[model samples]
Target: MEATKRLDATEQALMLITELSMKHGALMFYQAGGCCEGTQPQCFEKSSFYLRTGDVCIGTIYEFEFWLDKDLFDYWKHMHFTLDVTEGIGAGGFSLETPLGKTFIIKYRLFSELELQNLEAVRINEI
Candidate 1:
């Protein structure tokens, strides 16, 4: 059986990624650790932000890696994360898209038993 992808993005997110890339060159996504808005995925210009040694790269969008803190990954590994966007200034506004009045949010659903068996591989410190 073909493996099920662990990540996805909405149409709005895809279009917004294009717009952000035009100005930022290359981009990446990270689900920052903390409460409130910090939990939202933050988009950054590739090479601008550093990926720590144990960070987990759950998947990618348009060649950009979607990363998370390892501790965070343990709690979310059983779910699929769909990247979405909404209007508003995200907390502290660190994401590249935040300045454009957008916040990258995740829509999640638990993996089905069958899907869990065929889910794509996840990596740590590897792209």
Candidate 2:
């Protein structure tokens, strides 16, 4: 059976990503577990942010990597994540989309039993 993807993106989010990528060259996403960002997804130029040990590349959107903190991955690994966009700046104002008056967010749903069984394996420290 083909493996199921752990992540996806909304149309609006994709459009925003395209815009950001064109402006920033390449992009990457990191879901901050709980810090000054308060558990929000942050977008940065691929080389701008540092990936910590054991961070998981859960999936990609528009050829851009989407990462989760190792602890966050362990907690949400059974769920499917949908990348989304919303108006207004996020709490941290550190993501690429912040200056554009939008913020990337995550909408998630639990994976089905079959999906869990066939879910794609995540990459560790691959960023």
Candidate 3:
């Protein structure tokens, strides 16, 4: 059976990604789990954000890598994440979409038994 992707994007998110990519050159996402901005997904110009060692790259959306903090990944590794967008500035104001009044978000669901069995493996390095 084909492996199921650990990450995906909503249509609105994809459209915004295209716009951000056009304006920012290239883009990437990082979801840090914690208090404050930690709970929200962050979007950045590809080379702008410094990735920590052992960060887990769940997958790609719009050809850009989507990453998660290693500790957060440990907590959420069994779920599938859907990249989304909302109408508001993000908490930290660091994301590219913030200027456009949109913030990247993550909507997740637990993997089904079959999905878990065919889950795509994650990479441990940043792009």
Candidate 4:
């Protein structure tokens, strides 16, 4: 099926971050071993994710990351393979359907807001 607005914990986290910046949380996405065999199973992460945009492949993009506290993290932890579950299998093969008549596709695996912040800190520290 074609997705109209795909979302994972990262994307959700991103939404949460954009909605409530500085929130702490963790989100997880499911990654099947590809649509074939012997592929590596892994997870994509987005810490303090926030925002939405568009991509060429998926049409629209609902940028998400992680940003939540302990309670929030706990909430997210149990939302794997079920709640907050979207499409894609690691990498850039995911999509989702939304009620707003738009579709989102994740074309890459990047860090969320928190991860970005962490990276920024690392960069500043190195500077």
Candidate 5:
């Protein structure tokens, strides 16, 4: 069986990613588990967010890595995530898309048994 990628993005999210990358140079996304960002996916210039040891990178979009907090990854390891964009600002948060009148969100579903077995391995952050 072929590997099933653990993450993906919507068409709108892809278009926005291109725009952000053009302006920001390199981009990365963090699935905000809680706190200030309130579970939204937050986009940042790759250099801005510090990757702590053990953070998990599930996949990428247009060469931009999408990461999750270690604890969050542990909690959702069995699920699949699809990144999406919507027409609103993220409340009190500073994701790059917020200023553009968009908010990044995650739509999730449980993986099938076969898909779970075929899932691409997640990488542990070392940078």
Candidate 6:
């Protein structure tokens, strides 16, 4: 399905990438299977452009490569995505929300620090 609303969030993401590109030259949002509820975004230099066995190509804008895992691309084939911007959030990311109220948020972060910290603390405490 088409995006729910104008991809304003994506536009903001692209804008950020544009600024980052000046220094990094290349960047991409890598979609990998995380052992959790939502997907993880890994940003790196653009030279790392190798397609995996089941990768689906998304459109490229602002000199950035975009791709999605095959499973994820097919999973939301009928839903719409939109972007919501708020102050201090620095232009959030796309979100898929269905009429029934199920929502999925896609965002780009430098790393998974929160998850790592939580896991480390929990594992240390358990020992």
Worst 10 residues of 1 by lDDT: 90-99
lDDT of 4: 0.28
Query: Candidate 3 versus the native: TM-score?
Result: 0.93
Model 2's alpha-carbon lDDT is 0.87
Candidate 3 residues 1-127, lDDT tens each? 7899999899999999998888888888888866677768889889688889899999999779998888778889998999889898747757788888788888989999989899998999745
| Per-candidate total of colliding backbone pairs | 0, 0, 0, 29, 0, 2
Model 1: pairs clashing at backbone N, Cα or C within 3 Å = none
- Model 4 over residues 1-127: C-alpha lDDT tens digits? 3322222334553453333323323332222233531122122344222222210111112333222222223223222221232433333332222222222232334345444333211001011
Q: How would you encode candidate 1's per-residue C-alpha lDDT over 38-122 as one tens digit per residue?
A: 7789898886778777888888999999998877888898999999988887476478887777788999999999999998998
Candidate 1: how many backbone clashes?
A: 0
Give the runs in model 3 whose Cα sits over 4 Å from its true position. none
By summed lDDT, which 10 consecutive residues of candidate 2 come out lowest? 32-41
Candidate 5, lDDT over the whole model: 0.87
What would the C-alpha RMSD of candidate 6 be, to one decimal place? 16.2
Pairs clashing within candidate 2: none
How do the predictions measure up, each by TM-score? 0.93, 0.93, 0.93, 0.17, 0.93, 0.48
lDDT of 2 at 14: 93
Evaluate model 3: give its lDDT: 0.87
- Superposed by TM-score, candidate 4 places the C-alpha of residue 82 at a distance from the truth, in angstroms, of 23
lDDT of each: 0.87, 0.87, 0.87, 0.28, 0.87, 0.42
TM accuracy, model 2: 0.93
Residues 23-118 of candidate 2: C-alpha lDDT, one tens digit per residue: 999999998666566567889999788888899899999788999888777788888999999998747757889888888888989999888889
Clashing pairs for model 5 are: none
lDDT of 6: 0.42
Question: How many Å off is the CA of 38 in candidate 1?
Answer: 1.7
